[model samples]
Target: MAAPSPRPAGSYGMDASWVPWLWAAIGIVYLVLAGFSVFSWGAPLWVTFLVAVLGLAFLAGGALFWNASAHGKFLVWRELLDELPAPARVLDLGCGRGAVTIMTAEAFPRADVTGVDLWRSIDQSGNSPAAAEANATVNGVSGRTRFVTGDMTALPQFDGGSFDLVTASLAIHNIHSPLGRRSAIGEAWRVLSPGGRLVIVDISKVDEYIVHLRALGAALTVRRAGWRMWWSGPWMATRILIAAKPGASS
Candidate 1:
């Protein structure tokens, strides 16, 4: 594929942009109520002060959510990218709009990166295979990257032991069930070549994944991703799980 003119690479777009918008909207409603309480409702001073403070807190929370989605997640991903060894074939699960996909392609210039997704906008804002492809073009990695419409729970198009590196970022949690997430993780492990690495960054149910991978005999290490990955606050912090598939890569 011919590479399109390079756009400034920072356009990863926000994850679930409506979340922050909703938080800010609620904050505005509270602020309006706080003003009415003090001016017309004739409420007590402490009550109005409390309402105003709550409004500000919600607004701040929204800002943090927006920051994490647009910039903070990428910060954490960049660090993870640096730590990754170069792979000849990379597969990214649920790669919404190519944020992690394009980054991996750029990080490993020789690697052929492929992103698979269901293109559900609920999981991410403006998510589509076309948008992901366009993002790859914008980042000048179109030549080496491809996006496909597929479910992580069942990737029948790919053969077993097809990839050297498999990655997922805040994606498997969308499965919404322990069994479904386990199936997705199992597929990821299945596609991974012997001695390959599977990296997952998720906000919930990572322990369940660890348990499942351990059952598959994968050597695993997991760590909290820290403040840079906090979606809304520390309570929603993400975790990274790295599982090394045993044996030697042919």
Candidate 2:
């Protein structure tokens, strides 16, 4: 097997190389569509509407396919698992393909990690329980990890204050609407123990994401990964948002 790459500096998590290419391809496709819209001065209304619809379809398709990759999973693992304490109990929301779940088990050897996902047929790729179990065995953390199929908006299997850390990596945007995302966040908040941390890493509406965290009474801190510095720099870089439940004062 190939050796794992060394972690990058000033990074709290794993480096994901494929994200840049995926974003570039999506940007190029949308730019080309916009160019066509400018050039087609006399195009019919329906034609323009069709082009717009197709562009959105392509964007969504690309995002879903990209999210299924191990690289994306690694990114989530890095952002969410890096700061957690040992012997932690972690809940991975929308744990597609169990990449993040398995990685968490391996990285935290002492922690118990549980993954939950909707497991919709369309989004299902190689992230099944069998794959996750095999990965855990290979990584020598089989005792610490497990995966379950479930929805994020309603995590009935988990009781309130059950976990030390709660994470949703690139999964929030998959919800059908803003209200759905909020409900998912609410579920996460409910499952976390007081003083536990919540981490959400995704390309979503920043304002809305922050608003949901605020509504949960969490104190938020945002960090930019080094990989995103080339394009977005410190200002608009891909983010890892960290929030904590209020803890008792000393």
Question: Whose lDDT is greatest here?
Answer: 1
Residue 66, model 1: lDDT of 86
| C-alpha-based local distance difference test score of model 2 | 0.66
lDDT of candidate 1 over 185-222, digit per residue (tens): 99999999999999999987898999999999999989
Candidate 1 vs. true structure, TM-score: 0.92
RMSD of each: 4.0, 8.3
lDDT of 2 by residue, 121-173 (tens): 34444445666566666666668878888889988889998888887766787
| Total backbone collisions, model 1 | 0
